[model samples]
Target: MCSGFPALFFAVAYNNPRDSWSQVVPIRLRLLRERFVVFFGKGSYGRDTLINTLGVLFAAVIPVAVLPILSRLYSPAEFGLFGVFAALVGLGTIASTGRYEAAILLPEEDDAAVSIACAAFLFLTAFVSALAIIFTLAYFIGVGSVRAHSALIGLGVIAVAFSGCVQILLSAAIRKRVFAKVSFARFCAALVSAFLSILLGASTQYAEGLAIGVTAGYAVCALILSRVVARQYGGVSLPDRAAIYGQVKRYRNFPLFSLPSDFSNTLATNLPVLFFSTFFGSAATGYLTMFQRIWAGTSIMVTGLGETFRQRAATERQQTGNFNRTMRVTLLPLVLLSVVLCATLVLLGPKLFEVVAGVEWREAGVYGQILAPFVCLQFVASPVSWSFYIAERLKLLAVWQLALLVSFSLSLFVGSKLFSAQGTLAVLSCVGVVLYAIYILISERISREENKVS
Candidate 1:
């Protein structure tokens, strides 16, 4: 019965609430009569709770469940070294041949998606090799140090990046409403990664175990993901490079200039650990990293909200060439979730941290309480920028880049000088709010113009 609500919703939603209740009764009867077989059979699996829980499961496992156990198994110094390596790996990844994989599902069909995904895998693989050669040389030549040996770290990064390609396909599968297959791939990865982490921890200490588990797990995950993708999509062809490039060029407005802003955002958000290691000890950085993860957990809300909005906005735009409803839906949740998340993180993060993270990170509780609110604000503010992506306003996105530059620079300098470790959180939060406010005004103005045009 509840499974039919989403499809039946339009009958009621398209009219005034007072009048729509009468229509809903008839619509409900009609839906059950005609669509009962579909709804009860497959649609039951696509219920809201099932969809949401799947998302939350991945969000929880990726950062918290897996990483925490790995963290405890390893030393802070080793972890910090790994963090630095991850920072570098993550940096180049954003531009891995221009995120060719993500170009899929943009109004583009599965074939376009396939090309982008395949091209992205090949591109990122080559990109990884180049980076490995460059970094490995630097490590040996006294230029830089990548912990856990460059070969292992390089392998893990490549595997993880490839897994990213698989995850994208899984996400595309979910978007296409294939819940059972998505569930299979997700749990398989989760179980394998979790077990691998424990086994690896039994022998290798610190970053080494974490790195191996990640690399080996990626190998398994990628294989499972490919099988599931093949089952769902059936058959593939060599991607049309020209056609793929055409698609990329068509959406050139999407992430091109905004790409740097995205990268900077990641850096500004996580670079604190680098600063932490430099200023404080490795242990101090580790204490704070757990809080960073908790804050990331709070961001799951933002991700969900954005996902819902993107779908709504796309539907609206196709039908009406504007996004008024999207703005309302997206912004309302952004504000409401921001408040709830910020308050909850501020209030409950301490107790929650202690229970979840154990005694080694008792200090992380205070860190979570202080940092979590800041992160909540940042996460809430973040999705507002997506409107620019949807509206083809990368120039406006670039404007925020300048704002981000100023904010990040000021935060880094001022926060480092004053609050030391604590100040980074405050500074980064402030910077995020400033940028979000700019995005809000710009988004509102664009919507107003769109309305005027209509």
Candidate 2:
């Protein structure tokens, strides 16, 4: 029968009331269905979050589903190279827009928002051009990794540009409340990247193929989201020079404070891969990369929820001048999710890796077990920490990010000297737990103080 058959049957039974069983069962089922519909209906936070989460789920699953095949097709050292290349691209992408994209949702005026987007694009162009120049010089001088893998220089530049564009366009989409489009864009990117990676791996079996797939995926995502933003915003236009400069000045704090904060945070997060590659060797870096990929798969839901939370919290702050209630509601579910994730990883991490990605990846699973608590806490803290942005506490946020960088670097250094790769990860995880806990506490306090002021 059709998809609506069960609903129709229940409705008819409820109306007819042939017996007590039919009457009570239909009524309860109908009520449950109605509740479900309402809870995820249009314009509801639940609906937006569900859309984003499902999108992220599909995106995350694609790469994860190919891991078994990819593991067999490529060597650990090749994966390690891909991991480092990704880290560099990530760092560049974070700086590309000069943090202007983060302010896209903060402005009240559509014109102002458009101007900020235009400014972000301008920054992105300059940043990418400079990156290309640097990469060219590095290739000529045979400096660092770029000299060894000249192809990566071009791939890095392309990935950074596309990734930066995706970030800017995504902010515009979020502001316009076109969550489904955002979700679709993400899924498309992931699908394209995963498919290309597998296809290229089978034929080329080169690390460059992996990076090529990722860059192509970002290009696709950027193209899709650019169209979505164009339709939603009635085509993005560059404001007059005066208008663009005005918006830039108005949101100067974003570049000044948010840029550094974001850069530091990204650097801290990606430093371990570089460290592993440098000190522990490529195989170790590969294992760590695998663990991070698995962690990323689990955390995509949190990332999606956080996107919705940021938009909702921003709206609430604009209306009520505080988002304490929204923050609290978001926090509880995240904590519960964290608990479940931690328990699962601690118990089944290595075994799960062995079964899914082959015996060679068991080491990565051990890394997962060691880092589970830290990542779980991170899953909780990252969303709540948006309070720093909401409350205009950019300076404080920058300080905290710097502290995280220092602490993380120190932990990695000390742990590496004193212990094995697993030991170093353990130490890093411990430091992360403490820092993330402090972050959550401070975010709560910020929300409370904003409430009191409001």
Candidate 3:
């Protein structure tokens, strides 16, 4: 029954090959069973991992499905402004919760975890408020032109808060192994965002509609996730002032170090947009940004797996004092898959882009091809990089983050002077590959050291 094979399969014998189709059934059944064992085995890479990965994939697929329509409706220059806005908001979101949301799963007590979540949300509110004040002050003091798109930035502020809230809630759900709730909420959010973006693009003539739609999508997802948390985890109650302060003190390292680490990581990731806009043009930035969005499928997979891996690795390290197995299970398959995908994209990315998106985006496909190898390395290494956090190697993580920032900065400087936008992308992608390759080694070394101590 588990195999879903027909009952008649058991009645046939292997006496003759021509006797019946039963011989083929057993072979097919065996292959299916092997795959089941591989994906749903007795470890961190089991049913939960599969569910989370598939959920992330589903959520990502929705936006990708509608990208062609959105692309046609908007110009590359418009998308460039959206890219800059998104990059800034992304940078702000990294520090919104001061990385405290990441600590939600570490505490043993549910109430303590709830308190941590509260602290994160409160910190995010305060952070956004401070940013609003600073930006307002700067605007009034004869720097308004410098901060030109204040309205869109305000939307970004609200969206960052929502993003932080979603992170807190999702972290809690992951701790509780409530994969379905998180998945469903994400899927709904993506669907709503895609629909609104398409509708606004069709009905309006500006890029702000796309931005607002994106923010609304995050708002909707945050609300949906909050409801799920309330139903499943009894809602996060505000801890007593003492409990909240205590949790903050306990997790001070998260804000102190993880904050900067995550912040730098975000900046490093978005450096290309800034560089492209400055050195090339807004249209070039738009093309690069669009490619990144289309490539979000792979990034989401890495993130989904990383979240599940973080939870699993923490538990495994706590119980068995070993994390090496988690690394093996999480990285091996991803590496193999990345290799295959990179090869395919390198060969067909431009043609695929032209056929699927439009002739206008054919150049994006060429960029995608050039960037494929770097992305492949990133896909495999980024998730495993969580091992550093699980091992409580925050300082080491921060160092790597700095190294990444430097690498990207150097690549941009060198590439800009040497060649055109496409050439710069190629150079940057190569540098990305090198940095992530080093990251993989660092993560592996950390795991191995921890294993020895255990």
* The best candidate in terms of lDDT: 2
Q: In terms of TM-score, which candidate is strongest?
A: 2
Cα RMSD, model 2: 5.8
Each prediction's whole-model lDDT (CA): 0.64, 0.87, 0.83
lDDT of 3 by residue, 1-454 (tens): 5233444454453445476585757777887989998878654357777777788899899988888888888877778878988898888888899899999999998899999998998999899889888877876885864477777777887888788888888888888887877889888888888888888899884677778888888888899888877776775566899999999999999999778878899999999998888898878888888889988865776776787778877878877776778888888899898988899779999888788778887888888899999998988987887787678777777888899999899999899999999999999989998888988988877765643321
Q: Give the TM-scores of the predictions, in the order they appear.
A: 0.76, 0.85, 0.83
Model 2: which ten-residue window has the lowest total lDDT?
A: 445-454
lDDT of 1 by residue, 1-454 (tens): 4456765666566766677778878878887766755544555532643565565567355656665566567766666655655555566556554555555666547777776666556666776667667767777776444543665566556755655566456555654666656666666665776677677776777565655555665566567767777776676565677966766667564356546666676666557777777776677777776666566665665665565666666567667877777777677767776777777767876676666766666666766666654565566656655667667776666666666666777776677778766666667666766666666777766654452211
How would you encode candidate 2's per-residue C-alpha lDDT over 147-215 as one tens digit per residue?
678887689899999999999999999998888999899889998998899999999888898999999
Model 2 alpha-carbon miss at residue 286, Å:
0.4
Clashing pairs in 1: 74-206
Give the distance in Å from residue 397's predicted Cα in candidate 1 to where it truly belongs.
Answer: 1.9
Task: Rank the candidate models, highest TM-score first.
Answer: 2, 3, 1
Query: Clash pairs of candidate 2?
Result: none
Stretches of model 3 off by over 4 angstroms after superposition: 1-45, 141-148, 233-237, 299-333, 390-392, 445-454
